[model samples]
Target chain A: MASRILGRLPLDEDRLAQDMARLAQAPAPQEPYEVFTIGRWVNLNLWNASGDDGDGFFNGHRQVAGRPTRLLGGVPYIGELLTTWFNTELLTMVRARNVVEWSIVPHRDFLESGPAEDFFRVLVFLEDNEHALNSDEDMVFHMRKGEVWFLDSAQIHAGVNISSRSRWSLCLDFKAGAGFSPGDVFARAGDYDPAIRPALVERAPAPADLPDRLRALSAVVSRHNIKDIAFLLGKVHFTEEVPIGASWDWLVEITRASGDPALLDLAERARRFFVHSREVYEEFSFVPA
Target chain B: MASRILGRLPLDEDRLAQDMARLAQAPAPQEPYEVFTIGRWVNLNLWNASGDDGDGFFNGHRQVAGRPTRLLGGVPYIGELLTTWFNTELLTMVRARNVVEWSIVPHRDFLESGPAEDFFRVLVFLEDNEHALNSDEDMVFHMRKGEVWFLDSAQIHAGVNISSRSRWSLCLDFKAGAGFSPGDVFARAGDYDPAIRPALVERAPAPADLPDRLRALSAVVSRHNIKDIAFLLGKVHFTEEVPIGASWDWLVEITRASGDPALLDLAERARRFFVHSREVYEEFSFVPA
Candidate 1:
């Protein structure tokens, strides 16, 4: 699994409703960052190092050097709840809102200049809207109101609001080393169920593991899983920085080792569809000058 | 313009026929560098360094350090013809053949390792067949028999042999600094015509020139040219290593400057289709771990 719901925080719906009522009366927040998101998605900074309302430093590392300042007066209780639940200092808190049928473009949060593992985030849904948070590996979760989710911010992810009304989520950023271990928190919250966890597909599997992995993949190469597997392979190649040629070689070797002719054919088709096709070139051929 | 026919070489069809006959009778050539090409494309190395028949070092730089060793006994005249036409030491020569209905996957050659400008390739069509070479910007050209083309190997390009019969081409690679200039050669060959040259889209445009370029693009943003401009914009973003957020900013500024609502709408749609869409994320998101 590329992402996990670390834990669910126990919270009162009545208190969250009060927070929402106060938030409705508060002034509208500014854009999070210049052109960082698309459509009607907007962010209201609740806490950050700089008290500037426009400072869009949502990553925990950026907030580590300065004292956390509460930017808004309406969401103090939400921040307190997150701080108590995570057992760590909350560096930044943001109320992200997506209007009807709006979406945040898929992106990794701490990618540009920060160490990804140094930051983690929690999303406390404020509205029960038809919205889904999707990871790069195609894993999606429909977060519900009063439900706290420890989101893996390191993965490429996005949010889409499909309901008629706007969707709001209180996003909290926490420094990684501040006595906040997500695994331990999940265990404590009783959400660390291995039975529900998806299979972990490595980015660059060892040559020895290729055959077994391919066999497993072959067994589940239906319409439902093929797209997910394809997305995973693409994410792996990108994250691993593997060259297309080398990646194709691995696919070929894995296909041969699978000893499933259908899988071999599927692999070839996938290479043609996802790799050799013009659409692939247009989308992925980013060779920096 | 993405591609152009540089010049036509004067050669007897009977002589080319004879060469093709001899090539057909010669021992089958080994595959070109592993996984560089796809389908039934094969290379019969006529001249290369290392004197190894399997050595697939066809790039111009690799040939500079060693003497050009003629690999086969037959078709020495073909090499002589290329030597005289290019007016430089021909480092590597290979008879590239693509079987009927075969296609080379769209790809850029010498893109990963070498400076693209350090090498230039010439393709002499040995057999007239229905074939077209496509570039990243959607430019396509068909080579005629006895015609010589100075191929721009730096850009992403591909070849498709659509004819029912095998297509043969004599490929020559020349070192860039060995008193070999493509412009000078094309001028000397009387094939340099400014009237026929297509528009030049710079890989990296200066910041000052961006506004004028965007205006020019605006003037031509018809339904027909939108896709090409979109592709060019994508190519620019990738080649310039511009972040998505920054690219969107540019698009927004350009859209406003263009003063064209249609163009602005097109830009927004392009963003959704190319950036926020799941298909784009699935194909293009290669994050180096």
Candidate 2:
């Protein structure tokens, strides 16, 4: 399995506060895909191809990781933690995502990019948010503070933070092959103990007539509320029994019933842009171009 | 007895290289005072009132120590080191100065500002520079990598880096009364060890014709070369057995011999502005206003 608990790092509240205080001085830049999130979801570059702190996007042409940016320097403990990973050469883009009262739509990453098998992903929870939840194709889970997990991003995955507090996590992208394993990444730490495994999320069964209830959104769906409706639909997958991809299907169904061709096209395009093939800079808009 | 040895920190080359690599990407900002140095003299703020990485100058009004700036976050080990201080509340502004082919002219700091006795200055040499030399009123010494010293900025002092390599040092300003002592600052470090104390800088006696040699600079010193000549004279104190303040005196004498009324006034004004009362933001320019 690509996803499993790897190891953990020592938690230091003072160090986290220092990093948080520095980040608080400036507002986080908005990510390009606005419709993918309901509330604030900021992706800050910790290590990337250009080694520039201000650069959050990946430069596909130059896919080489350089030195840590100034942002990483300010959070020295994080920088020191990165050094502990043995196969650092396999790493590429490393970023910290801080989500506050946000819900991310279900999507498969690297669908239009490099070979999914060659990419490995890791996630470390910097803080524990009780209401935060994440799900992959098969399982939903909650990552606790300092817990490091091998996140399988190639699978359809989504996240939600219903709480007002922030959920901070470091997402590490590694370009590696079948030979690379968790052992290589956690070489400095001892072999993982089975006791640290995550508990499966207990989600409620989908209510009968759920589709009819979702279809009811068609009456209220407008050009203005279309994006919010789509995000709200995505959030349903976290609490109820439904296929992760059902969120997009519901969006498409709701918009088609609206009798607005433009609304239907927007819903379809958003699904494709977020989960299927999307041009590098392709952006989905509520208004037809 | 304002300046003395404190203690040392563990030297980590990889950590140092990590910080140096990040700093190397961007040119360090020039300090406010220009005439005091010969080459690149960058004073970067690690901690200050505003907690802004870009601000290097001290704001005398708000004399409170705030959170570490983005710059300090990038150097996490340095941040950790700062926390080791027992009396961090007493600190106001802490900065790191990097000098490359630079020499600071002899002058007393805090002369026109806060009570000199209340300000406790500490210097920690970040790297070893064989050619770097610093002088207080009576003694000149070369600080090595990781060595921490209590610097007396109230007395006449100067620094020079004759080497092409960079000399980086952390300068901390603490506000306290007679109750505060080096014991409190180094409480975590235990009692001082006499074995690690610095060696005094060896110097030759001043040349018999030193006065005439400096006075003869009147022939070559002009508006274009006056600042450079002043810095060169300041550098002389690093090599010869002359009082630290002789650099300013030599400048005044050279300008008097030049018989240029404007040049004489400029020299006197430069001396006064640096070592005496200078209204905040008052800049000394070669061009007469």
Predicted structure with the largest lDDT when compared to the true one? 2
Model 2: runs farther than 4 Å from truth? Answer: A1-289, B60-62, B187-195
Q: On a 0 to 100 scale, what is the lDDT of residue A154 in model 1? A: 59
TM-score of chain A of each: 0.57, 0.91
Residue range A190-228, candidate 1, lDDT tens digits:
554333343222334334543343344333233212322
lDDT of 1 at B226: 35
> What are the runs in model 1 whose C-alpha is more than 4 Å off?
A1-289, B32-34, B59-72, B93-95, B131-133, B136-138, B178-180, B183-289
Error of 2 at A243 (Å): 83
Tens digits of per-residue lDDT for model 2, B1-289: 7466777777678877787666544434434564455444667788887787766676653456656788888887777778874357767778877775556778877765666767678888888888788998898898888887888877888887754466888888776567766656553647444357686888889878778756766654555345555666677767778888887888999899989988898889888877776665665554332
The TM-score of candidate 2 is: 0.49
Please, what is the TM-score per model? 0.34, 0.49
lDDT of 2 at B77: 70
Give one digit per residue, the lDDT tens place, for model 1 in B1-289: 2456666667776776776777664443434342222223456666666655556555443544334445455665675565566544534454445443334433456643356666767777776654333234344456777666667666555555433356778776666655665655442555544334432223343355544444444433433223323333432332232332344445545566658777677666545433334221122211101
